[model samples]
Target: MTSGKIGNQASLQSIFDPIIAAPSDRPFVVAQLGQSLDGRIATASGDSRGINGAAALDHLHRLRSNVDAIVVGIGTIIADDPQLTVRRVDGPQPIRVIIDPKGRLPATARCLATGDSKCLVVTSKAEAVPKGAEGLVIKASAPRIEPGDIVEALFKRGLKKILVEGGGTTISHFINAGMIDRIHILVAPLILGSGIPGLSLIPVGSIDEAIWPKTSAHVLDGGDVLFDCDLRHQRRG
Candidate 1:
């Protein structure tokens, strides 16, 4: 077995190479989710703390440090209230973004607090921007904002490397919309039996209809398995 110390650094660099080398013409979007062995992100009550081990958590912070911006839905803000800062390791913090189409984000959300990183809220044209944060309004008749529009707007703003750090629904939308280039799934060695699932894409009639991205797995410290899935070529047409 490979030592976590030696393997972790090499694996992280390898995982980030594609993202760091992406072209500047468009946004290179990656989504990440931490789930149980049974694919549950949280319990039914939504308590999702400490699912993956310290090494996986450090890897997440590393990802945040390397990316230009980190995006999440309002649901994650409400449920987790994450700071979205790079604290586990010594590196620059990334810009924090939120997808709150209906203007549901609270004024005092932790992510909105001032820090080294700026915060951007993606909302519908009619929604009011939350105080203390910049806004990127997209035209949408429905309450939901399109994932593609969000990506395009960010790219236009010079945030070409984007990380969709999520609460499942947000990640699902980007993945289903074919806007994601890669996905990193960290699965812990425990099973919740029943809880919030990690991904919820559209239904498929047969096994052949399921997605099959080019994937590689690495074992993190504390027995968590990280699946690095390259979805750039496998996205739906």
Candidate 2:
């Protein structure tokens, strides 16, 4: 892991010692996002092309270069049509995993187009898998697939290091379920005024009931702030 500096002299490793020290039994899930100062991930139109500064973008690419697999929700696939491969960084690209509960991702999606890495489509339905992808049918207990189920499926497939890039809902589910082992969030200076939230979940009655993770803050290349939070899955009682 590269040393991303904190406020003064704290190293990224120092801030993430707990997370780095975690057992390697299963994939170490990391949730990453680039949000606005107002905590909005995208504008009202769902545009999230260039919110992150160059440095943060590079950081994101480096992150992508390291993980064994990358995961995103079906909404992100439909909205961004991302080719979730590592660019602007030197390393092997991670496998792309898409959670499309209904198996609705279009075959023409960019992620399904071209990349050296493999793409795994996770859906609850056993119907047709999108072209250029492998299918893993995980039955849903609710209207949607559960976070724990996704993790289990990936882990059993030997995906030991995972990164989850987002479009809010998927990240919220993982966060609320305490399934996130660590997170890398870049808070930009721009404000969206009105847009989709970075983390949208059920309301919490009190701050005391919140799950507090050990964190380290740092300013990126263009004055954008990066917050690295490591969760032990322990919530305050």
Name the top lDDT candidate: 1
| Model 1 vs. true fold: TM | 0.93
For each of the candidates, the C-alpha root-mean-square deviation to the true structure, in angstroms, is: 2.7, 3.3
TM-scores of all predicted structures? 0.93, 0.90
Tens-place lDDT digits, model 1, residues 1-237: 122332557647977899889988878998899999999999999999989999899989998988899999999999998999999988888889999888888998988885688899898753478778888888887778889888999988889999999979999999889999999899899999999999999999887778888787888878888888888655342
Q: What does the lDDT read for residue 201 in candidate 2? A: 72
Best-fitting candidate, scored by TM-score: 1
Compute the lDDT for candidate 1.
0.87
RMSD of 1: 2.7
Query: In candidate 2, what are the lDDT values of residues 1-237, reduced to their tens digit?
Result: 223544332343354454355567866888998999999999899988788888788777777876778999999989988888888777789889999887789989999887898889998776758768999899877878888889889989988778889868899898877788888889998988988889877787998877676766787767788888777644564
